[model samples]
Target: MFPLSLLFGFYFVQFSSAFFGTGGIFGHVLRYQKLCLCRCGVSGVTQFPDSFSNVRLLDGQSVSPHQFPWLASIKIDNRTIAGALISDKHVLTAASPLYGIPPNRVSVTLGLHDGCTRNPALSSSIETVILHSAYVSGYSYNDIALLRLRHVVPFSQFISPICMPDFRTLESDQVASTLSWKWAPNSVSCTPRVATLPILPVWTCLLNRNSDTITPNKGCLGPLGIKSIVCEDDVGAPVMSRQPYSSSFRLVGVVTTANCDHTSAPYYTKVAYHAAWIYEQIRDDCQCFSI
Candidate 1:
């Protein structure tokens, strides 16, 4: 295994240099140079489908009306940015898109079927946008930002929140599998034996470590050691997990970065990690509205 100190050193160098916007020099090195840096690998239970209807555009259709029930289009002074509804009062998105824009200049369009081709006049406007206190411009660390709508959206089968995973339920490899192996104390084993044991990695939901004491110019990347679902145009999308209580989904993660393209891995802000912060933001900024 590579030295942990070396791995951390490399990561810090890359992160710090990139933070300065040095023409993305560090990013280029990491992406193209094939640096064998040790990233925290989160092995766990999740399946990637062949296709997702939420992100894909329909064939022969410029806009997919009702493709995703809770999808929303965010507009700031006539310029549109991608966003999605994660809860009745919360809309999730990336911070970069709204960096310099004032709150009044931003408006969210809800209950929209076709945002790409529909006229702006056809959509309903949101009341307010509540940006995260630590949102930054260039770097996409704590890339998540929330929008608190003036009114609450009624819960419907088509429009419900996603479920979040429990952090307490997460177990490490040794604890998750109840198996043990023993070697003969006095015998030398020559033949190699490979055990075909399937081990699933534990996935823990986490939140911003310093959400309350955050600064406008500094967005925290992570607490470290978690799997992220980063995607492009995922800037303002909702990361949801299906729930068992009903056929509804629970809000788990928020779409944050476009750094991971179609060919690259995606990243998302873990919802379970920041549920308290999210609740606080919603309670403080939003008012319930009927559909």
Candidate 2:
């Protein structure tokens, strides 16, 4: 099995060169892989249990293993951060974790509800790290990123991808949430936390200092008061929302920047705005993923 990945690694190198010559989707692939390409199963519409039989959330961590299957963890620099499994081959997160860490040092672990406590069976190696083209050193608006796994994650009761939202379905003043694990003040263990916040108008997020960077592509999680909900290590937490009639939760934004003050809503990069860029990374056109 390892040899199979290595075999593709060779072809990936060749195809990547040809991809560079084309300079279209190839550029997106180039930006994502950062010279090293990896994979898991390419793509598929997966089935997940709408109702978890034995799952609960205490703070920001799930009580059972399969409670929140789409919630995954990115491990780098001996620190584990939150992320969401958007597909079998891709996990969505903020650009902060990958900023200074070496790509090879990162891995995404799925199917485990308690990310802070134990190692899970379903882990994928990092293949590529793609940050938004407009991302800068300190600015956080365009902070969304994709991590392509080196191997396919077998979908199971304990592992699945979250739903991707269509902009048309997200009406104004919709309720969205952040599902993550947090370490509280003076607490030894982290617990699963859930904080549902209203999707504020983009204009509201722009009223702050340096708010000119606010665009339709960003989301604000304030106006709901959540200082008691979010934790210091909860960055990259998925901003999720359930469709009106759907049981499964879809990913809407990522925890890019947040405030310890509930008075101030945190900032997240709206996933809908980058829908096109995201599709380009996971789509079959790249020839980077194999089932």
Candidate 3:
């Protein structure tokens, strides 16, 4: 097997050239390696699982808030990585796996139900993959990237854009309450002669703001609980939110990094902190939608 560092370097070189339009030795190498282009496999469809199912391969289904067929599948060469669609042209994914890679070399496939069958007529291909400029390995900050496809994905029940959150309105306490709260207090409890104060919930720390020396960057995580964000196959996946009255989903976090093997915790980039940067990138690179 190739050294992990070397593999990363190789990927970076290939990614930079394709996305940046820079061409040279690394580009040639990527071209020769066929790393610059990829196709979806028939087996790629098996990758999707119902979110509620206990079985890893065939669980229940994707959660409702994220229940669009377009929000799925990352393709590189013949290999396919899992991804989620956030916009007409952008697919969100883990930064660690995609850092230093080129956008053209990566193609995101959407609207597919299974990988075992090939249906070019039904699937759509994205135009490019844009890695967050500030992404760094081993750090949760800026762990997300957007894949921009050549064409706009039409809106449908199976294919649609997610509602990004208004970062300006997000509060730390609100986040805490949402992730930790179980049930609201009963209405009659306050009127009773003997009523207990609502319990202040405790949260598991998902990101340690102080643990790693890296200053909190655009995509880094602070302290959070395990339930706040769990480890999943697709890194760079967006953590979206939709309140009861909300009309659309809003991005709250992104999968920055995780050590599933550690059995300790998973970390995510706080979307609120980097909302501006995210919008900037989308504005500069994506033509399918307006920022």
Candidate 4:
């Protein structure tokens, strides 16, 4: 844990000195770094408090700016998909979005509140796309992928990485939520939104759906009520759970199938099940700090 704090502190000083100078913001960064070490877990600190309880992504409310700093947008072939920042240089997303797309055609945007515009200062190009070896096209099994950025991301008030869940500590009935962005009606831009999604037992999911297609590697979420609408842009969005007794949030799932229609329960690649694969790829540079 001390090493993680030092890792964050080094980056804060480096980024702040390069961009914000050595006096005011530098001192502020130092103080904030200490605050992070003393109070908040290094990975999941946000600028604002969580107010996303009971909200729905498609039929839910909008999120405040910097509310979920780890949320990121992946733009590929002119289409936008949601992703979660898992480290300084990697993003966790659904492999479906990059099924046939090349890394050269994909770009990542962090510190975003609107989905319609791309902020050049906050965007990065993909250096590599690591999809799970078992990932199959058109199926939800092994649907996770990691996008390695060409540059290191600087954490700030509106940009940060999320904590990875300790699979060993996960519970079947823990409350979860999905975060995504959708085009506003009659508007040119899109806004970020969140919704409550309860995790369903794997046995219950298997009994209710295509038993042959669904696997234990996936987690079932929601009943997408009658009013819910399909959220295509949410394909690579994150399904997260708040750390008990802490203000931090951890990645629990990566959305693969998102449909808001009645009787449709979006399925996500369970992060717990793939903890080995994910850690193997990022263990050198990323660490999950348990609160």
Q: Which stretches of candidate 2 lie over 4 Å from their true place?
A: 1-64, 116-120, 183-191, 207-210, 224-228, 285-291
TM-score of 1: 0.48
**Scored by CA lDDT, what does every candidate get?**
0.42, 0.66, 0.43, 0.71
lDDT of 3 by residue, 1-291 (tens): 445665675576556756754345543444322121111111113333433222111111223222344345566665455555555556666667766566655676565543445333234555656667776676665666767767766645445554455534342333311110011122111110100011111232413434453334333322333322233443544444434444344555555554433334335566666656555555433212112
**Candidate 4 TM-score over all chains jointly:** 0.78
Candidate 4: Cα lDDT at 73: 83
Error of 4 at 152 (Å): 1.1
Could you tell me the lDDT of residue 187 within candidate 2?
52
Candidate 4 worst ten-residue window by lDDT: 32-41
lDDT of 4 at 272: 83
For each candidate, give its TM-score against the true structure. 0.48, 0.72, 0.55, 0.78
**Candidate 2 global CA lDDT score:** 0.66
lDDT winner between candidates 3 and 4: 4
How far residue 127's Cα lies from its native spot in candidate 2, in Å, is 1.4
- Mind giving the per-residue lDDT tens digits that candidate 2 earns over 1-291? 446666777576668666664346665555533222333221122542443322222343334445566778788867777898877688899987678666799988776655456655577788888887877767776888899888867666667677666655483477676866663544534445565666777666666425676666777765543353455567798888766565556778888876464446667788888888887677542222322
* All models, RMSD in angstroms: 22.1, 8.1, 16.2, 8.5
In candidate 4, position 291 carries an lDDT of 59
Which 10 successive residues of model 2 have the least lDDT summed? 34-43
Error of 4 at 115 (Å): 3.3
